[model samples]
Target chain A: MQAYLTLVRRELGGYFNSLTGYVIIASVLLLLGFSFTDMLVKLNATPTYVPLTELFYSSYYFWLILLLTAPIITMRTFALEKFSGTYETLMTAPVGDLQVVLAKFTGTLLFYLLTWLPLLGCMVVVRYYTGEATLLEPRTTLTTYLGILLIGGLYMAFGCFASALTRSQIIAAMIGFALGLTLFLLSLRSYMPAPPTDWGAKVFAYIAVGDHMESFVRGIVDTRPVVFYLTVTGFFLFLTLKVVESRRWK
Target chain B: MIVRPIIEVKNLTKRYAGHTAVSNLTFEVGRGEVVGLLGPNGAGKSTTMRILACFLPATSGTARVAGYDVFAEADQVRRRIGYMPENNPLHLDMRVRDYLRFRARLKGLTRRRSRLRTEVVMERCGLKDVDRKIIGHLSKGYRQRVGLADALVHEPELIILDEPTIGLDPHQIRQVRQLIKDLARNHSVLISTHILSEVEMTCSRVLIMQQGRVLAADTTQNLQQIMSDGGQVIAEIAATTEDLRACWEQMAEVEHFNIAPAEGSYQRCALTPRGSFDLRPLVYEQARLRGWPLRELSRSLHSLEDIFVHVTRAQGDGEGEEGR
Candidate 1:
């Protein structure tokens, strides 16, 4: 357990020490701030009675930004180690393969969650302007943050898996972006004109990240998406561990 | 008291997709013994070392390091071995001190122990000056020291160094060699290097491997005796080629000889005698009888390179020729 925490701490320090990490944070903050202001301007321009939290969460760009940024946070997780040949040093340590994977997964997840803190500023600003201390509607906000974590965890795990597959950070980032885009695109089946006419529609609806967020925005906490996201996250992280171990043979 | 060897391997083999890197290798390093794994390129030295270090599972057979099976009890084995892999893999982004501390902690040291060991190892490896420097910005010598410090951060029982002095300047090489020799006083070290002189200077026993197998294993002095068993001599005579050839043809001990045209009116001759005997005096007597001015006559000491070439080429089936 201590070894795992030490690895996690090192990984977190790596994220903070590198320029790519700071760039990701800055870009996420910029995009979220811009989108928040745009949503506010549109909401105030029109007297429509849209809920403030709902208005903040409705932007399609929110998911797109996350899909793009997930790769940045995770591309270096294993790829840089492999590229620099530190993987050999890492594997020969007393720590287990599962521990290394878990540490990287958790560290990136924490950093991913931290990037969303700036969005809370939008929440605070909205509450202040509305002359209400609790404009976020507690239940809606909690469920929405939970949805963000689950979905983002899944995306970052896929990025970690991608990083494990190759020693090139660029390739890892590309694979992560492609994988996240695929998941996001799979969810977009809900908006399709014909929407699948069979069980496919149900599967897509069940797995659609946007639908899950929408439900959370309506203050509904479903256990199915929680199980789905957590399972996918665990599966990807398991694949990452396998990839790390199999590299020895290659 | 029965003392177990620090490392023991029996018929260990590692096979890649295209070829076997190490095959049917068996050896052991006793406690406090410094063993040098000497081999030419593509001779499975690193493969064997990696197996012993618990970096890769062998394809067949078994290896035990520090009383732990490499395959079954890898973590325990890892805890006992300090491995500096080929090319000295290290985190280039971290400071030297920070990297050592991180590695110490990762090796399961407590906070105080990690800090103390980091300082001790940094000083031992001559890295105190570069502790605050980022690894990537440091020179190759300093980085190599950092790699050494990293390997020693936890002070494991067995230290496995693969090409520990590779690519270092002569002074740095000497310093690292001295440090390794100093370490061998308290720790069992298995070093694999192309520099045979390092082995001669530091190793108590040298293992010469070729074609993924042990060609020879003995003390440096004993290996030199084996190398010199096929006697070799060199002579420089101020005589015509035919004259020297005729004189050489008279001696029964001279098996064959090669003469190269040297400076003005002189020729250099290399002769392989039939038995391990000092043939210089006989060659000088022949030169005197023939009235040939003997410019130089000396027995060529058998060097490690001759042994390496002889063993590697003698068993050459043309399979283990791939670059490692």
Candidate 2:
């Protein structure tokens, strides 16, 4: 347990001590600010009343920023350790593979969570500018935040697994971007016309990240999406542990 | 000096796809003994050290470190060993104190104990001045000291150092050498280095490896004695090569000799005397009898370099086929 925490602390320190962490945060904030302004402009012009919180999740810019942030936050988790040759120092220490993997995953996940905090800031700014007191509904707001957390957790774990697959950060980022984008886009099949079979529709619904967020934004806490995200997150973290362990052998 | 071996290996081998890195190696380092693994590059020194450090597994056989099996009880082996790997990899972003503290904690030290050991090791490695400096910003020598401090943070029983002084300046090298010597008083150290002088200065016993095999293992004095058993005689004769050869051939103890053209008419001849017999007097008599002017006469005892070259060359060619 102590070894796990030690690794977690060091990993967290690594993210903040370097330029990568600040750069990712700055980029995400800049993109979110741009997206919030665009959303506010549309809300002002629309005739029908739209929930302000809906704009936070419905904006294309928000999803794009999330996709971009996945690789940035996770690219260095394992790749930098391997590149700087610190992997040798890390593995030779009396820490298990699981502890190392979990620490790195959770550390990057914390930074991933921080990127979303600015979205809330955008929410407050939007509320103040529009003078809408009821814009901050706890039920809808909390579920959306939970939905983003689960999706980010899964994406960051994918990034973690990609980083462990190689020592090059560029390649890790590329792999993470490719895998994250593919998995995310695959979920869009749920919104398309009805499939030929019932199981096919179910599979599409099961994998659709957009459908999960839509359900969450509607204040529905279904077990299917939660189980799907958690299982996928756990599976990727497991794969990361295996990759790190296999490095010593090969 | 027959203390129980702190590290014991039997028929340990590591085979890659195309070639074997370590082949049927067996050796032991006793308690408080400093053993040097001397070999050229690609000679399996690093491979053997990695296997012992539990960073890599051997393809066959077993190794017991601190009385625990290397494969079965790797965590226990890791707990007892302070391994400074080749090139001494480190987290360049970390501060020295923080890095050492992290390493100490990872080595299973309590918070208070980790801090204490971190400070103690930093002082020991002459890193107190740069304890707060970022490792990446430090000079190479300082960074190397940080590596040492990191390894020593938990004060494990067995210390494995692979080329600890490879890139240090002479002054820094001497300081690290002195530190290793001091460390040997309490810990059983297994150091692998191509720098023969480092072994002579700091190690108690030397194991000469070549082509992934142990060619020789013995005390420094014993190795020197073994190499000197086949005595060599150096004589500078002021004569033609033919005349020098004739004079040397007359002596029954002189098996064979190499003659090189020296200044003017002088030829430098090196004679290998047969069966440990002193051939200086015999050569002197031949010179006196032939009236061949003798410029210099001396007996040459083999140094470690000479022994290393002779053994590695002789045994290397014989085992080349087996390695592939």
Clash count, one per candidate: 0, 1
lDDT of 1 by residue, B1-324 (tens): 888999999999889999989989999999999999998889899999888877888999999987789989999999999999999988877898999999999999999999999999988988888889889899998888888888888989999999999999999998899999999999999999888898989999999987689989998889888777767788899988898888788789988889999988999999988877678889888888878888888876678778777777867745455533
- Ten residues in a row with the worst lDDT in model 1 chain B? B315-324
lDDT of 2 by residue, B35-101 (tens): 9999999899999988888889899989999789988898999999999988988888888888899
Give, for candidate 1 chain A, the lowest lDDT window spanning 10 residues: A47-56
lDDT of 1 by residue, A7-117 (tens): 989988897766777888899988998888888788679764555567777776578678889998999999999888898899999989899999999999999998888
The DockQ score of candidate 2 comes to 0.66
Which segments of candidate 2 are over 4 A away from where they belong?
Answer: A46-51, A128-131, A195-197, A248-250, B1-3, B236-248, B258-269, B281-297, B320-324
State the lDDT at A194 in candidate 2: 88
Q: What is the lDDT of residue B68 in candidate 1?
A: 89
Which structure among the candidates has the greatest DockQ?
2
Q: In model 2, what is the error at residue B285, expressed in angstroms?
A: 7.5
- The deviation in Å at residue B253 for candidate 2 is 1.8
> Which portions of model 1 miss their true places by more than 4 Å?
A47-51, A192-197, A247-250, B234-271, B280-297, B317-324
